[model samples]
Target: MPDEVRELAGVPVLVCDPDGPLVATEQDALDLIGAAFLGAQVVAVPANRLPEGFFSLGTRFAGDVMQKFVNYRLRLAVIGDISERLARSPALRALVHESNRADHVWFLPDLDALDARLRAAS
Candidate 1:
């Protein structure tokens, strides 16, 4: 992560546009988020360029991330066009539906909406 990215942490929201294997490594992921809320009230990560297996690893990795966020009480919004995943996994669809009902984790379709939601939450 760069200094600019760390600066984002101080803002009210953090929109991430990562590339390659950054999302695959937990340290990289956390580092990217370390400064997302620099001094703001809330943060949101728009995972547009996440590596493969992030959602597919829903049973494992997703669950782990979700738990970590929940434990830290950090709100996260997964912004992506996840229609395919939703169609393939009924369980994932159910989880999305359930998560959407909460303020912490949201599976949104676009970044604008994600920003709006996070801004509203903050």
Candidate 2:
């Protein structure tokens, strides 16, 4: 499946494929704003499917991805378990914490948590 768009808490969201694009470069990140995510308020991407640089605080991939999304006024939810990666990088851990506290980008545990967050926000 390319991607599936579903409604959660009255919000349209596109749940990305687990085996889909590995967003390492700006081009990879920009691709999300294409046809698949049109009219979707949130786009969910699995942490495992993202490039390692996406989790690296010093890497441009993460910033570039977040910037593109913010510019387009799109919300992003990064789902899946990232405990190991978080453990290895304190900076990333801090960033995740900060992201969770914000409304734009979130590092949620899974799709269920994403649903809960959206529901709670409503």
Candidate 3:
């Protein structure tokens, strides 16, 4: 599926579906950012759309990916419950929890939750 731009509470967001290309790296994220003029402040992508490396702390892919978004001043919402991954790694679970607590990144169960959070932030 193709990525689309959506608006929530006056903010334009880029919503990437699970069937879309994998966003595994900073460069891939930059490509998504490039799709819009001036870029989007927030992006909603399925958890499965991310690369496997993103779930492994030893790989540092999660940190790198998050840093990339931070550098661009963009917030990311990774949707879906990664229960299996969280169960396998305490570190990953902590990271997810911490990211969710921050304003810059969030891990949501669905688009409706993302929309609700965005609405509350506005």
Per-model TM-score versus the true fold: 0.73, 0.93, 0.91
Task: Please give, for residues 1-122, the per-residue lDDT of candidate 2 as tens digits.
Answer: 88788887888998888888686677776787774456788999888779888888786678788888889888999999999999999998888899899898999988889999999888
Q: Rate the local accuracy (lDDT) of all candidates.
A: 0.62, 0.85, 0.84
List, residue by residue over 39-102, the lDDT tens digit for candidate 1: 4333445455555566775547777776666666666667778888778888788888999998
Measured on C-alpha atoms, candidate 1 has an lDDT of 0.62
Clashes of 3: 0
Which candidate leads the pack in lDDT?
Answer: 2
Candidate 2 has what TM-score?
A: 0.93
lDDT of 3 by residue, 1-122 (tens): 57888887778888887898898778897887677445577888899999889888999888888887787788888899889999999999899889988899998898889889988987
The window of 10 residues in a row where model 2 has the poorest summed lDDT is 29-38
Model 3 worst lDDT window (10 residues): 32-41
Off by over 4 Å in 1: 1-11, 18-21, 40-43, 57-59, 118-122
Error of 1 at 82 (Å): 0.7
Count of backbone clashes, every candidate in sequence: 6, 0, 0
Q: Which residue pairs show backbone clashes in model 3?
A: none
